[model samples]
Target: MADIIIKNVYVLTMDSYELTQGVVVIENGTITEVAESTEQDADQIIDAKGSVVMPGFVNTHTHAAMTLFRGYADDIPLDEWLKNYIWPAEEHLTDEDAYIGTKLACLEMIKSGTTSFADMYIHMNDVAQAVKDSGMRAALSYGLIDLGENRSADVELSKGKQFVLDWKGEAEGRIITMYGPHAPYTCSEGFLSKVKKEANHDRVGIHIHVLETESELNQMKQQYGMCSINLLDRLGFLGPDVLAAHCVWLSDDDIEILRGRGVHVSHNPVSNMKLASGVAPVPRMLDRGVNVSLGTDGCASNNNNLDMFEEMKTAALLHKVESLDPTVLPARQVLEMATTSGARALGIKSGVLREGYNADVIIVDMNKPHLTPVYDIHSHLVYSASGSDVSTTIVDGRILMQDYEVVCMDEQDVLDRARTAASGLVERAKF
Candidate 1:
């Protein structure tokens, strides 16, 4: 019952084709028409000034509220980071802190041109509420870690079940819930088999970490007598609905297993490289017909900022250098990993800018210094544009950000709350 006309834009339109520019009409949170619209009654008009309009970025896996822990632990091995710094800090988090931290993360994500993301963490009720308030689309999962005795496992399972019943598919259907069993090392075979049963019955998807480190690969091999992927495969864990993050240590057989099972992989290039997790064999995954998407992992590991542009650039160049082939993961394919492929990975219907797709869109300001002399817009977008270059963001036909200001959130208030939360958490964490 409403119309917003975005005009005079270089519209990237991440449709089936590569780069195409045209007008888009958004009505009631769904794109009614894109390009060559004959009807022109508009309620809202945004002059893009030839800025690129593309599908909003889909962050395939992240811990949104972990922004509070950014730089709290760094330059450490994955096991050390988890056991020494991150887990200790996480134990001190309150629901209020999660709310504030997720708000800050959502603000940063929108500003950086991400409309939708998949998140895995604890206190997901706070995270989901924050997503609803910020008007961002997300798939949230309560991470189930049964590291303690059997009692601890029961507690985790209870919390995860409650999260599924309470918050799944909330926020006007902008949010979907998933089951997260942390990873292989923390969860036992019996626990994971139970998780698979829960997933099957609940008919919900799963978001999990997979082969993120050489340690993980080694542990699975030594402890389980199988590769990590094979262990999951034996448990029937990989599916079309399964989204596995950071396949940095996957082998050729592992890639085949994932492809055969239709498992979606999220390539967190920055986070992996930062953790020295090694290259993910992204080109090999692509060659094997895997649905490879993009993600920032978490601000803690990625440093800060949720800019998919930087992630895309890293994904593109990292593969080429790792494979020693210039033709590996070109700009266009890297762009797909952030947009449509990302959507596909998350099992969402709105990756491309077209009719019937959800109105998830971002408008970039092309007048910036780095984006000038626009020879190829896609290349420039992947290689040059930063998160700050995004001028406006629209998700579900509602303008969440315009002229670099977020409409659905108060950035200053979030900043204050997060600062307070961080100080308190540090004190309570005994750090």
Candidate 2:
């Protein structure tokens, strides 16, 4: 007997053009079978007749606890938004606030078919706990910064290292740990180099922001007499273990550096557009064979949502318009960016539905009026389908949501706690 079996659904393995009527069998948190028919019985069987089963989305970059700051500061530049409002507001957040905020984020992501994510923020222990309790997979890191603040570089790096060591493979191997140095402008060169060394020493990955805005590019040139890419490269900090977010203001040379170093890029189109950060050259990066993945930075900068479906649609449309070519990012490629590319960025095995793979999957209901005529499944998924279309989300062979009902966590309780937390945060921040 298997642990669970899902039958009567169209399986989009994402490994190949294997979209067909099939049944998927799960056992021991892994996919045991995916084929036309399974002769196996399961303790729990799900008959998903009118849905398409595929890999769940992996968010490559996010500040999960920032869910508390969603809609709190909107329609502002990245610098002003962060320095004036967001940073000030963050000072008032308690551990309980971070916990509730992350729980809310996990609830939203699970409901929207996101089974895993990469999160960097303060109070990351609380964030990790929330992810564990919510039954989601995550790569977590403590946001590190050392720019003349009261916290010294050693202290900050020590804290980040503690986080990495404490949660390297926690949550039954569902949580991976990384060292998150906030960004180039925020952290000094010495600090970044130290962080890279620590990450390499621990054999973990490093997540950081790189040139999200023109201002950062300008600041780097002024301060270091070079671009952020060149400075980081000079420090030997660029590598496959680096997850760089928002390469919006990159030059051709910078893109080459990233590709040469085999660094992963997490393109947050929604957050970039919202913050007026320049658009990243995704087509150029893809054309150069760089592994460009998709991410919804955080709720605060992305219309207060973690819906990867919206992220997919926005990425497809944004790149096309920016390049003045409607055929730039096709539906299938955008879907890959959201699923396969993101998984690769996080070094996870959940992006493709295959035997012996992690059972991080979602069933999208295509029977809606909007998705009435299924001319092309890929097209419908990338261009037409929304997060609400997801009827089930399974992570590690566990049914987090089934038939539009969330089973892993209390949905209403999370929402209520989130509201209370947000209210208290507002009072504390006085904004």
lDDT of 2 by residue, 319-364 (tens): 8998899999999999899989999999998899999899999999
What TM-score number comes out for model 2? 0.99
Task: Kindly report which residue stretches of model 1 are placed more than 4 angstroms away from their true locations once superposed.
Answer: 18-21
lDDT minimum window of 10 residues, candidate 2:
147-156
Pairs in steric clash, model 1: none
Q: Scored by Cα lDDT, where does model 1 land?
A: 0.88
Residue 107 CA error for candidate 2 (Å)? 0.3
Per-model TM against the reference:
0.97, 0.99
Query: What lDDT would each prediction earn against the true structure?
Result: 0.88, 0.93
Where is model 2 more than 4 Å wrong at Cα? 148-151
Q: What is the Cα-based lDDT of residue 156 in candidate 2? A: 94
Global lDDT of model 2:
0.93
